[model samples]
Target: MLRSTGSSALNFGEAQGANTDKDYINKASISLKEFKESRVNLKILSKVDYGNASRRVELLDELEQLIRIIATIIKNKK
Candidate 1:
């Protein structure tokens, strides 16, 4: 999940350097998908792997916020 999550940002950064609309759209779409998956995996991981619910919730909140920010950027991109 972390790999995908980070790769999404990395790919998107590359897309920003793309020379064509098609390339930008393709990379942005993949980034959006990866971000969503990462958000979901974080939820599952926090529940199934955490020994401390409070810490898990905190981390979940942070990851969710970051995901939302990324999603919003993807959505707003022209």
Candidate 2:
């Protein structure tokens, strides 16, 4: 999932034209949505199991940060 986001960001950076930038932006947007869904699923899983809760929390935090970064990128691009 992170890989997809990174790939999209890289492609966006390397884009040669406005059309290419829009395409990569859409890809990044989709990746953001998927990441958000994964965050929700992780939250549910954590609620179901107390073991490794701290690690799960850390991951959730990282995912949220990534989401924010991607959102900012998309906003600035538009």
Query: What lDDT score belongs to each candidate, Candidate 1 first?
Result: 0.74, 0.70
> lDDT tens digits, residues 1-78, model 1?
669778877987987888876677678778777777777877787768746778767767876776676567656665
Positional deviation of 16 in candidate 2, in angstroms?
A: 11
Clashing pairs in 2: none
TM per candidate comes to 0.66, 0.72
What does the lDDT read for residue 51 in candidate 1?
A: 60
List candidate 1 segments past 4 Å from native. Answer: 49-78
- Model 1 residue 11 CA deviation in Å: 1.0
Overall local distance difference test of candidate 2: 0.70
The per-residue C-alpha lDDT of model 1 at residue 23 equals 75
Mark the regions of model 2 whose C-alpha exceeds 4 Å error after superposition.
1-19
Report how far off residue 35 is in candidate 1 (Å): 0.6
- Top candidate on lDDT is 1
